[model samples]
Target: MKRLYRALLWLFPPGYRLAFGDEMTAVFEALARDRRRRGKAVYLEFLLTESITLIAGAVLEWIEKAAGREYPADVAAARRAETDVSVPAEIIEARQRVTTLVSLMTDAISRYDYKRARFYSLAEERERRRLRALETGQA
Candidate 1:
């Protein structure tokens, strides 16, 4: 099942996959683990539902790409927020830094690299504080 899921993830655009493939794989594994505890029937149902969703999502992503859209809609929303004219550049940079840190932390956690994850967690906290300060005009 996991193999199939990973294969399906390859259907996404290369850049999108590079950014989100590991995270999505981690989430799928976690969900599968939890559902397995609920019994075979529930787990099988989850697999069917998730597989359908994955295929549909990949198709939509491809369509969006073909239409000249860059990034998923959710990611475009985040980029829009980041680019708000009212927001200071420093704040935007800090927010982006924090986001990157969080992604690194999650990737580390997914790989069971606790030490690396903890390092990223601490860095993310610092960036979060910097972002807050920038937002409040204190930095």
Candidate 2:
């Protein structure tokens, strides 16, 4: 059951899984065990419900990711900073670009496209370095 649960987790977006997979798995395991204590019927019901919900959640998350509706931690912080009138638009735009590159890398990895993933990884790193250099007045 745990193995099946782990396999089903692959349906989730890579970033979402990276952020919450272990914790979600742990919680699922605990709930499964507790439900089993009631009866086979109860346990089966719990498993079915959980599995369906997980699949639905994964679909929604993928939609959000594809639509650019989700943001990474750093990007979200940068977006929040945009609310400040003093923050430069260029910085916010750069942060958003980095976030997009990261999302592309994760998507590539999820699809088992290592070459594309490597390219995006390098691109993201270069962008981050450029941002840092700009901050330090070296670029």
Candidate 3:
């Protein structure tokens, strides 16, 4: 029941789970309870939907991991493909940033706590400023 749902959640990307994991589980539990009141089939429908989302959410991580993997290049064609077909490093960095935000937002969204993201963002900005001030010896 709930255990199975919890286990299925592990299929989601790590970034996603880092942010929204527990909140989503709580949500699923609530939904499951509601569905149980309705019928087991209704609960099953919810479970299926969750499984699909978990798999889909994992795709972003998989893509990034695949892109980062170093492939064997014994074949000349492999080397050419590696050199010729690729995303720019900037795009890869941007993707990494987006993954971070996605994880943060997911956590905030699941917690029903928008302020966590906002506060963290502001804190980061403040810390950057403070570091700059420190570097300049300006307190």
Candidate 4:
């Protein structure tokens, strides 16, 4: 069950994953805890639905990125791996899950995810160069 969650999260681009992995897991854990207080049936349903939705939403964003000329491989795998499951019925269900997860993901992407990744990568490179400079003590 947790593997499903992990598989779904694999859709996030590495940088986005690094930024939001813990936060998303926390949210999932809290949701699971609340459901446990309710019932096993509900908890199971929540797990299945959330896993599907979160993964589907990540797939959508991966498509969006690919369209924008960014090849997000990890994200892409989450989508392509299940190509045969693209029938209309499954798609409709996936779409519903995607709707909820997409809302949160979109919000995160806009708020901090994408920008932070880009900034982090740049800053990391700068730091590495600085370290090298310190070692060399010359341009």
Give the per-residue lDDT digits (tens) of candidate 1, residues 41-108.
99999999998998898767655654557656556666666668987787778766765776676668
lDDT of 2 by residue, 5-35 (tens): 9768756655566567788899999999899
Which number leads on TM-score?
Answer: 2
Better of 2 and 3 by TM-score: 2
The C-alpha stretches of model 1 lying farther than 4 A from their native spots are 72-139
lDDT of 2: 0.76
Q: Can you give the lDDT of residue 19 in candidate 2?
A: 66
Q: Candidate 2 at 136: error in angstroms?
A: 43
Model 3, TM vs. native = 0.40
lDDT of 4 by residue, 103-127 (tens): 4445555667876546544544454
Q: Estimate each model's TM-score.
A: 0.50, 0.52, 0.40, 0.44
Cα miss at 51, model 4 (Å)? 1.4
- Compared with the true structure, model 1 gives a TM-score of 0.50
Query: What 10-residue stretch in candidate 1 is worst by lDDT?
Result: 10-19
| Of candidates 4 and 1, the better by lDDT | 1
